[model samples]
Target: MASHRRPTHSGLTHSARVTVLSAAAATAVAALGATPAGADPQTSPERARAAVDRLFQEAEKATERFNSASERATHLREELGQVQDGVARGQERINRLREALGSLAGAQYRSGGVDPTLSLLLSSDPDTFLAQAEMLNMVTERQHSALQDLQRAQRSIGQLRTEAARDLSDLERSRAAVARHKRTVERKLAQAQRLLNSLPSEERGAFDRASRSGRGVLPAVSGDAPASSRAAAAIRAARSAVGRPYVWGANGPSGFDCSGLVQWSYAQAGVGLPRTSQAQRYAGRQVPLSEARPGDLVTYRNDASHIGMYMGNGQVVHAPYPGASVRYDPVRMMPISAVTRV
Candidate 1:
């Protein structure tokens, strides 16, 4: 059986992790107050906008964690199903072995009720007695072998059951982690929304407009061609998704998050990609930003929480974040971490 080991976030319990994350989020929101005390009123709008942007970034990180946990849960569930199926088949085999052993015992019971040695001694013909003795010995050996087979089968099933139980536990933990990360993401987004709402109408409109800036317009990408046919196909798929809503955790024709868009686009190109940006960062050979071509994955931030498909000419098509549509942005949007050529 394959190992179903899951990565742990911390030694903390699920509830404890939730509490810690919530507290951290609250502290961040407090520090990045909607309006700091005695601050320059003129820069309040700028400060608020910055704070909201930070919150959105934090939420994206949480969303990636959520994706990781969710993916783990999916694999664990699959492994659990396989283990359970093995146990069931093992049980059926054991039943057949049991029936065979029972039949052997019944044959022995229906035979003459004297000890084998006594029967041999009481037999009138020595040759006939010897032949009967050999047959009885063979029956005993077969019974012993059947018993051993049953014992081994039982042991194997026991081990499989244990594995299934362990997988179930891991699955539960993954589910908890998924829920916790989801809550963290929600909290961060909510804080950002509240901050945005607190801004003056004009400032809020500006923020909204900036978020929508990528909609309905795509920068002309020139210079380097896609490194591969698959890359080119993925780029075309991503471009077709322009103006789609940025739905967190979605990887589809309609909506997508950062890594989701990457994975979905690659999938359209008949290639597979990992579920999270952090993992997707290593999906292929790493290259410097200078070598980036259309369809290369351009990851952002040291943790690789954000990713976009490079479209050459210093442009990329990405699902920015909530309230934004999939659109074109500069490849240097948030400090390029790594450019991966898939």
Candidate 2:
């Protein structure tokens, strides 16, 4: 037989080829092990920023819900107070009526010894005759009237008590809603913060620079005159708050949310607006976006969850989001829900 030998290729021994294949398999395993589980190897900074922006928008929506619930709770508290006061006043009236009826009963019992009509007519003293006559008339007519009044007061009190109970229940539900919305806002903001933190330092710096560039700049209005004097005043008020930080549910000189900024600006012009964005959407006459003027309320998003004061020239002054401030943006930054002329 011919000399037997292990198969070999490329002038390498069979055992050496086996060793090389084993090493390549180990390298592949190591590469797979080095990557974190469920992580995308090609995630980009733009995707992260977009996610952060979405979270901020979600947080703003929750903030509006919180504001609405808080306002409802306040209204319920006032209504409950009024109902309680009415109940108390009704109870007082009922007590006085009962005392009056008791006195009338006592008078009738004391005069039970004689016929009331005969006693009154044959009385020697004029004063006693008048007193007994008046009492007899009151016993016939005023007695029935007082009883009816008492019944009415009792019914009114019962209705007020029922209202109070209903309001209390509503208030509790509103409070719970407020708390739930608050948690949602906090959670969303936290998620946004985490996304921001995950970004590279250069990207984060670029984002901060972009935010700064957008804020504190009041672009000139295009129109020579406002739609009205109140509108002019509101535009001035909004322009004055360009650099104020955005705060959820805050309507103030220092900070504001989207609708809060609009509400506060209009309030400075002696115009009252609703507290939340959705309500403010219908607070005034609706106008088309093309006809929007300075101080017109430009509501955004299909749900009208965001609002800004139009500053003419296709610009709007709005508190954009939590990390942003009162700033100027294009009127069409998001979808135009409504243009309200307040």
lDDT of 1 by residue, 233-280 (tens): 998899999999999889887899989999999999999999999999
User: C-alpha displacement of 145 in model 2, angstroms?
Assistant: 1.1
Give TM per candidate.
Answer: 0.87, 0.82
Task: Give Cα-based local distance difference scores for all models.
Answer: 0.81, 0.77
lDDT of 2 by residue, 235-278 (tens): 99999999889899899989999888888998999998889999
Clashing pairs in 2: none
Give candidate 2's whole-model lDDT.
0.77
Q: Which one wins on TM-score?
A: 1
State each candidate's clash count.
Answer: 0, 0
How far does residue 162 in candidate 1 sit from its true spot (Å)? 1.0
> Root-mean-square deviation of each candidate, in angstroms?
10.6, 14.6
| Top candidate, metric lDDT | 1
Where does candidate 1 have its weakest 10-residue lDDT segment? 1-10
Query: TM-score of predicted model 2?
Result: 0.82
